[model samples]
Target: MGLSHRSAQSHDHWFVTERDELHRSDAIELNGRSALNAAGIDIDDVVYLDLYSCFPSAVQVAVNALGLPLLDPDRPLTVTGGLTFGGGPGNNYGTHALATMTETLRKDPGAVGMVTSNGMFLTKHAVALYSTTPPRDEFRVTSPQLAVNARPRRVPTEHYSGTVQLETFTVRHDQQGLPERAIIVGRTGDGARTWSRSSDQGLMAALETEDLLGHSMRMADGHVEEISAVSREGLF
Candidate 1:
């Protein structure tokens, strides 16, 4: 399945969007679940899945939303390996995924396949279910955004400075595949979200060594410092 730019504003090259304001994981899950329901199939009936793998979290979020096992031997997440190994091909990656899924389903008639597509940093999502066997009802498309739009939104701080709690983050790598920098999304004491980047080699290495999804840190003068994970005892 393919997903196009939702609006002219989202047509830009930015990582964030101005639409429903749903988290990528929530948006993906909504679209995926709706698609399965429209196709009159359950998640367990899907024999194949081609999840959009722009990043590890993109796939992880979808998996979590779909309630699928992280590592299923019989139903591995990808049919074309993934974005990197399968060739990202920019916005056309989903096309390749659909083509791959079609071929696989043809090999095993009556087997159902699901393909997911993402646009612009997971801002837009689309999922398509296919099978050799016809559905009990005619195929239909559902809009998950309607439900997502009703949820509350977390306002982001543009010029945030001070202590913050990490919500989620991703580490960038150099051409040689070594850790280079980190892009972090954090929440301030007031619940405002902020995005910051850190290039400190030592800090980046430490981040790679541990799971710091809820870690806290301080930002000052465009530098992220004082990295520490949240303790179970409610201490930082």
Candidate 2:
């Protein structure tokens, strides 16, 4: 399947419209159920469904999109400790989820759990089922023959303009392996773009004192120029 979040205002409308048409309900349950149905599967066979919740919106969209009962005292959602409490470690976090679900299923052999992985700033999705008595489910393995050609969506590439969300970004380190500069993946009214600012002094300062992760830096002209400089490698 596909796990995607509303990152672009343009895509949001398309997503909702298409999702409702395909699923028949603007709800997470319906979306999940619809996918299973598309594959000609039944929901009763699904013993568990874990809403891939990273942000509040994800949870909200699932609830609204699927026509699921808001308050189900019996079916309490959420398996992996919420994203805030339990770190959303990039790609491999879901691997942990699979292992955890495997153990859970091992304990209760008949139980089936659906594990969904949301990747790339919630831009993609994948769902897998776990059961002790498996090998019965038919599968269409994704293959290169599918011939999927993905190109970055059309983004406005004029002089720096428009507003964009910062998905996940990082700083690059120099030869000595020190944080030398920061490169950010930003989305504008157009699409996703990359920007970086380099200054050994500024980076040294941030490294020596402040932890740079999750720090926001605006794009002005081009580079995120540093103001104060201490030494070439060190910062004031």
Candidate 3:
């Protein structure tokens, strides 16, 4: 239908700032639906899909934004099993997806396929639809930045010392497969966003096994003071 960009990213944070109710990038859904609608199609009309997947989180965000079912047996999210599984040619995931979509469309004769692209911490996004059938309209790129920029933004806070509710987080493991560190994003009572990192073994372990979204915690100056009281007192 159409191709588009989200505009320049935030200077303080690398991740997308324009998020929807679910905290997924508004640009991802906007461009995906715009492309489908412009092509005179809809989600029902698409048979093949490849969502950008440099990480599982990216795929999940796109899936949620596009309202795709998380457990659909008929529609596999990726034609190549995604970048983590499909093999990443560095930053050329979109081209890989396009090549795979073309090959898949060739086999299916006329089925339509969609591929989503991402850049720099999911800050930039583009969507494209393809098929064996020829195009009826000329190609072009689109932008929904004006709409995106109008959405509510969570200002990044550098120094914070108080209670917070976890917005999102990721835990990293060491070479030995043990919990090593965690990168966390949380919001204060006033809704400002703050990011912090912690290498506490207990904290990282707890994060891996639990759903921490909305969990309360304490942070000081871009650091997780302690997670020892997490389960009992909700501070990490």
Candidate 4:
């Protein structure tokens, strides 16, 4: 069964269903599982997946949701390379993904494939499952918002000034392929989250070589001050 976001209008469209069938989740893993359950299938049954590849983290979250290894060489993550390689067509990229998945499932009859789409900074997610064979029962879709709502949310502090641990980050580059700025999301000592940007050329250069996830850093006056790696023993 295929899935898409429901529109506000009450138009009776095949792709746009009831709000209950329209699911939205910030957690990619939960979103993936919810889509699978709605389609009446398991992770093992899906032979193909086209994860939303706007960024690396999006792909990582989907991989985590499917309980797949990070470095699995057997399963290719993308059916059409990826957004960078396959051309990101703004909000309509998922359409291309679904088309590619459809062609793939047609060639490999009886096999199941999944396509994931994201809208607006990983905040919106939609997963669709397809197969050559028809389902025994009528296809049904579900909303995973309840499950996602029940999960704890990280409270963010606007002006946090203290030690923090890096949660995840991304570096933006310019057209010339040079590092431009770093967008960082971190958790303060009190468990509050904070987002900051760093344009320090030296720091950006250092971040390229370091695995900064979970690393300790200090923020002051709304700026990242110092960064340090967390030792294995220290973590324990």
lDDT score, candidate 2: 0.45
- TM-score for each candidate, following the candidate numbering: 0.74, 0.43, 0.79, 0.74
- Model 3, residue 134: displacement in angstroms? 2.6
How does each model score on lDDT? 0.70, 0.45, 0.72, 0.67
- Candidate 2 displacement at residue 120 in angstroms: 3.8
**Predicted structure 3: clash tally:** 2
What is the per-residue lDDT of model 1 for residues 39-70, given as tens digits with 9 covering 90 to 100?
Answer: 65678988888888988888887798778898
Instruction: Give the per-residue lDDT of model 2 (tens digit) for 131-232.
Output: 676444444322111111121233333335333444334566779986776554443433444444456565556645654433344455655433222222
Model 2 per-residue lDDT at 212:
41
Model 4, 119-184: lDDT tens digits are 654566666778878766666555666666555555657767988877667789999999999987
**How does candidate 4 score on lDDT?**
0.67
Q: Give the alpha carbon lDDT tens digit for every residue of 138-220 in model 3.
A: 65556656666666677678778988877778888879988788988877787777878898877887788876667778888
Evaluated with lDDT, which candidate comes out highest?
A: 3
What clash pairs does model 1 have? none
Backbone clashes, each candidate = 0, 13, 2, 0
Error of 4 at 109 (Å): 2.2
